[model samples]
Target: MPLILFNKPFQVMCQFSPHPSRPTLADHIDVPGVYPAGRLDADSEGLVLLTDDGRLQHDISHPLKKLAKTYLAQVEGTVTESALARLRAPLDLGDFTTLPCQAVRIEAPAWLWPRTPPIRQRADIPAGWLALTLTEGKNRQVRRMTAAVGLPTLRLVRIAIGPYALASHPLLPGEWQEVSPLEMR
Candidate 1:
């Protein structure tokens, strides 16, 4: 089985097929018969697993599997302790309530790569970083949750899914490496 860890670049689509205006995994990966286990929005960037094993894919992507996915978010304004508390609590998104999640203020990740278009910032105000871990993969959940608590996410990156992480394999943006299925779990 082909198990790949791909560092998806900012503005790149998660799928293997070509897109008219945006880059896709096909531009970075040439390995045949592998599909992305889960999706990262074009606006988000980071680790994405690609695999040919259906069981492995299901394990990683299925919401019922309750695998943890970690994100590093850069938000406008310094995140207040109260806001952090709200983020850690179960959030009501109206469509559905989110499961309790881990949220904490973090320093800017020392290892993060430069975003291509770059995140615009105010000369007067400083942005803050937060490390958030969630089990459910709701549509734009991190962004929405932060917005609900008065911190708008300016940039987002998915750093890990389950036990797999970009650091373990050490991939730069748009790079990919094959790993064993055991590494995914």
Candidate 2:
């Protein structure tokens, strides 16, 4: 089975199917039969795993498997201990409560690529970075959690899924590479 790691760019839809207004996976990846194991929002960027094996995809994406996904979030204000505590604990987001996860402040990574149409900046309000690892992924959950803590997310990037990491397998936006499925084990 082929396992592909793609560095999805912001604004790119996470599907092979065509979209009238935005770019899709088909625009970047040419490998046939492989589908995304999990989804990243069109507004988010970074590592997305694709594979031809249905079992592998199910294992990686199924919430019951509790696969850990880590993200780097650029938020609108300086992160505080209080906010970190709130994020580290289970958070209620109205529809569902997020499971407790690892949340910590991190310096903006030097290797991060700039977003094509850069995130908005304000002279008065400084932005900060956070590394959050969650076992359960809910729609727009990270963004909502950050907003609940009083820091709106300006940008989001998924850095890792389980054993694979963007740091170890570097790829610029829209780039992808194949790896042996054994490596995932």
Candidate 3:
């Protein structure tokens, strides 16, 4: 079973499962027999994996595999190095301490698309960019982590998963393509 990469746009659900009002993978990817290996929240966008192989799906989605996923997040508030340090450290989210991760503030790039329903903005308030990476993907982990550090995520985009990257397969919203790699690691 081969893998396909999709650049899931904001507001697109990760599965073929339909919502009463939102777009789904069925609306974007028409390939038969392929299913999403993992999920990205409808509010979050980018780098969704689809595969025909069940074992490959397990490898990518199961937390035990610990595949590294990297995200470029636009967050509300000026992110200080201290905040980055907090993200890097264990985050006691009551149930579990998030797996050790890396985060840092960087200049917001100009290439991102404007979200359909733009993130709420306060003229007096500021926002910054953060490049964050994690292994275990608990529910909304990045968002929760940012909120815990006092920087709410305004926009989130997964840039890469393991060896596959959005940079190599740049698809606009609602687009997908077959990854021609002979083998997946």
Query: How good is model 3 by TM-score?
Result: 0.95
Residue 41 local lDDT, model 1: 94
Give the per-residue Cα lDDT of candidate 1 at 22: 97
Q: Which residues of candidate 1, in runs, are more than 4 Å off?
A: none
Full-model lDDT for every candidate: 0.91, 0.96, 0.87
Model 2, span 1-185: residue lDDT tens: 89999999999999999999999999999998999999999999999999999999999999999999999999999899999999999998888989999999999999999999999999999999999999999989999999999999999999999999999999999999999888666
Residue pairs of candidate 1 with colliding backbone atoms:
none
TM-score of 1: 0.96
lDDT string for model 1 (1-185, tens) is 98888989999988877899998999999988999998999999999999998999999999999999999999998899999988888989889888999999999988899999999989998799999999999889999999999889999999898988877778899988888798656
Instruction: Name the TM-score of candidate 2.
Output: 0.98
lDDT score, candidate 3: 0.87
Model 3 per-residue lDDT tens digits across residues 25-126: 999888889999889999999999899988889888999889999999999898898999999999987777898898878888677777778888899999
